[model samples]
Target: MDEKRSVRISKTLSRVLRHDPASIGITLDEAGWVPVQTLLTALGRKGTRITRDELDHVVAVNNKKRFAYSEDGSAIRASQGHSVAVDLGLAAAVPPAVLYHGTTGAHLDAIFREGLRPMSRQDVHLSADTETAVRVGSRHGRPVVLTVDAAALHAAGHEFRISANGVWLTDAVPPGHLGRLAR
Candidate 1:
């Protein structure tokens, strides 16, 4: 499939699998998985016809590694970035000394004051590298990267998880633990 079509399908999959499965008349299980066949049927019904091979290709080649299949290949789910409540089943892990968060210039003031909250999602998504954070920030607008004192936060009793896609996950980052990296 072409990049445009693959991206469109990937976005739709993100919506249904992460944010609103109900929009497609389906539901994710507690761990955020749904039967692969069920997902295909629902997508077809919603006027987005996708074959199994296309779905496989999308999961295989998405740049961000946004989706995953079950161990037995029966189900699939978004690796992270869920708006709705769903346990990703990720274990708490030790993060590096630092991490990064990316956001637009518009949110910097509030972020500096309030720190980084998950907002609508379950956890504040973080990146291990500045470049990845910059790309994430670019999606919103003019990018700004923030350095997070992950080691300090962890020492202070905060928890961290590494998602399947390598995005760091945490409940929030207090202002004390954050510093501006680039604007």
Candidate 2:
């Protein structure tokens, strides 16, 4: 598929898998997975009409690696960023001493004051690398990077998990554990 078409399909997939499966009349299991065929059928019912090959292509080429196929290739799920209630079944993992979160300047004051909350998602999304964080921030506006003291958070009994797409997940980041990362 061409780039624009691929991107459009990817966005639709993200909307369905990460945010609103019910919008298309499909329900994700507790672990946020739906049978591949069921998702395809639901998409068709919604008039999206994505084919198996097209779905495969979109999943394969999504820049963020947002979607993941089951080990047997019969199921699919978003790697993270679910707005509805569904555990992603990701195991806890130790994060590095530091991780990064990217956001627009508009949210900086609030973020520093209230700490980083999930907002609409399940967990505070973080990135192990500054580059990914910056890219994520750039989406909203002028990007600002915040270095997170992951080690401190972990030591404080906060669990961390790395998603299939490499995003770091934590319940929240306290203000004391965050610092502006000069970029």
Q: Write the per-residue lDDT of candidate 2 for residues 1-183, one digit (tens) a residue.
A: 899989989899889988998899999999999999999998898788889999899888888999999999999999999998888878999999999999999998999899999999999999999999999999999999999999999999999999999999999999999999876
The TM-scores, one per candidate, come to 0.98, 0.98
Q: What is the C-alpha lDDT of each candidate?
A: 0.95, 0.93
Clashes of each: 0, 0
Query: How well does candidate 2 score on lDDT at residue 140?
Result: 95
**Which residue ranges in model 1 land beyond 4 Å of their true spot?**
none
lDDT tens readout by residue for model 1, 1-183? 899999999999988998999998998999999999999999999899999999999999999999999999999999999999999889999999999998888998899899999999999999999999999999989898999999999999999999999999999999999998944
lDDT for model 1, please: 0.95
lDDT of 2 at 110: 94
